[model samples]
Target: MPARTPWIRTFLCRSDNIGVLMRDPETGACAAIDVPEAAPVLAALKETGWTLTDILVTHRHADHVEGIPEVKRATGAKVTAPAKAGAAVPEVDVTVSEGDTVSVGALAGEVWETPGHCADHVSYVFAEAGVVFAGDTLFTLGCGRVLEGPPETLWRSLSRFLPLPDETQIYSGHDYVGSNARFALAADPDNARLKARAEEAQRAAAEGRFLIPSSLGEEKATNPFLRAGDPALAQGVGLAPGSEAERVFVALRAWKNRF
Candidate 1:
């Protein structure tokens, strides 16, 4: 038997937060990456007719878990939260840490302790499915704000995705591609790929579409945060070639913070 691809749906919620629903066709088991809000998740389930089986939380942020209780009460779905989140998140039926496997029917995702956006942040990498639900740790062309740990920690967390295949699909927590594209252009103006991606982002926004679920390949080629080791990015950030990637990354993030 071959591995079946899980069906995925992406929608906007809570102004900029992205809502995701992943369903296993073999067993009809469905999981929502983060709630953001209950209405959209419920409506999506109703529209797709996919039963909500689980809610996988990436971090303890209120925007991510605020809809858990209502959604759980309505669907009786199990909730899987990060162990480090502790009491910050509610209605957690299971707490997972690094290397833990979370199963939604026959589909399984390896839990990576990708803490940088927050102390409890975790990313779900369904390698076989070629998908990773990266909460706030990574975005379209940027990374999360360093709120909990140093930029080095966030760089380490982002590095977890570096080893994945180019085609791996990444679903981040928010829709910040427009701003990220602008920032990417400012940070790596010499990269033609970044320029093209920024134009694509502009067109997508004009068409009322989003650039969520971007491939690791695209991110690597265009995202400045992921290209900290590239000499072009180092120079763009006013650093010399061969500068430490971690140092470049910190400078880039600081520039982004002020950008």
Candidate 2:
């Protein structure tokens, strides 16, 4: 891993979508993680005075890929999308799969095929920078709904993140901490760490500051989805004690869907 960290700028886009601009300070090579909208992205570029060199697409969702055409036309940046997305996403200049590396100047991010939110979903882990752009696969307190895959599939995808360093910065696609906190509390009410986190979420909301870039360590400690392996969580979800982690995860996901 590189010793230097990339300069990161996080902003909101299109309602609740979290937009990120990651730049390598050494070379001024900047990448937009996903384009929720073009106007704000272009404005951010102008505001920061950093030229966009790449658009690292996370999935084929309309909200994520809608701004690609406009942004690409404006900056001529190379667009890299998931190979599994095929033609579902537009204006793709390159396609990447698992183990592929994407470079933004001096920084490199490894591509992980993390489906479950959708069959084409992927995540970008900049190990050198200790950050992961976790599309819709994983979120702050909750995880993405299993829209295109089974709950087990989604759990498997989430498992991929567990092995990262505790300090790894996690950048998810949306700012759903408010709603997610409610569900998390319902599912894991007795968790002291979760209670504290929920209060912090409230404080962040009051200040208009989002908890977008959460740490992997914090998620492990408090996120109900990540803690599904705990026997207590299985009991909370009405499952018998000692239920498999995957089963507990399915129960939690189902409850969240209705919650």
Candidate 3:
């Protein structure tokens, strides 16, 4: 029998927003996911003792790519970004669209066009690792705001992930788990699962731990944003079940923005 390759290690930078490190354990090669700033990223790299080999930029947002130059200067790492985000990314070494593949060490990742939060947004899926670096497109129990596309666009982007294996872990760009959980509760107040998860998340945050990398199964069950088309979600917000999925998603997003 062939030996199984161990999964790569993922480290959350836990910056004010989000930055993550995907390290190939065998080679000590690392890939950074959206560097908000260079200092924190450098510190994180030093702490982990991993050499950065590449950077995956999800969108053109400053918070996501501001540190690209600095990190690149320090490590000379190759950069990969969406083809549409060429101008926004200053030092992109490779530009890819949907279905393209990128590699670091022995691990391979496929690019998924996930626009909505930004027209140029993308997500990277490491199938072998069962993880998705979901930029600002999808959060733990929430999704990004509709800044550049219609709510339907965002809904479609999010829906693409629904068919993945139930155990696929979602690593989002922000640690907005607590806020999202609160909104989830409001959207499904009577859901025992949501309530239980929210309480657990609150306690985790209080203890200075982040609630993230939420499983797809957990999300499908409690994330109102992901369940916009569900009858329970529509009923919770007083919308009829026959309403369009986009309409439900829009209403839920608008409500959560205030939440």
C-alpha RMSD of each candidate structure in angstroms:
1.3, 1.1, 2.4
Question: What is the Å distance of residue 9 in model 2 from its true position?
Answer: 0.6
For model 1, residues 1-259, the per-residue Cα lDDT tens digits are 1256899999989999999999998899999999999999999999999999999999999999999999999999999999999999999999999999999998999999998788899999998888999999999999999999788999999988998989889999999999999999999888898899999999999998899999999999999999999998889888999999989999999999999
Compared to the true structure, candidate 1 yields what TM-score? Answer: 0.98
Off by over 4 Å in 2: none
Which segments of candidate 1 are over 4 A away from where they belong? none
Candidate 2 TM-score to native? 0.98
lDDT (Cα, tens digit) per residue for candidate 3, span 1-259: 1122323344444354677888877776689988888887898888878899999999998888988999999999999999999698879999999999988787788999999999999999887878889999999888999899677899999999999888888888888888889889888888898888898898988988776778888998889988888887888777998787778888898887777
Full-model lDDT for every candidate: 0.94, 0.94, 0.84
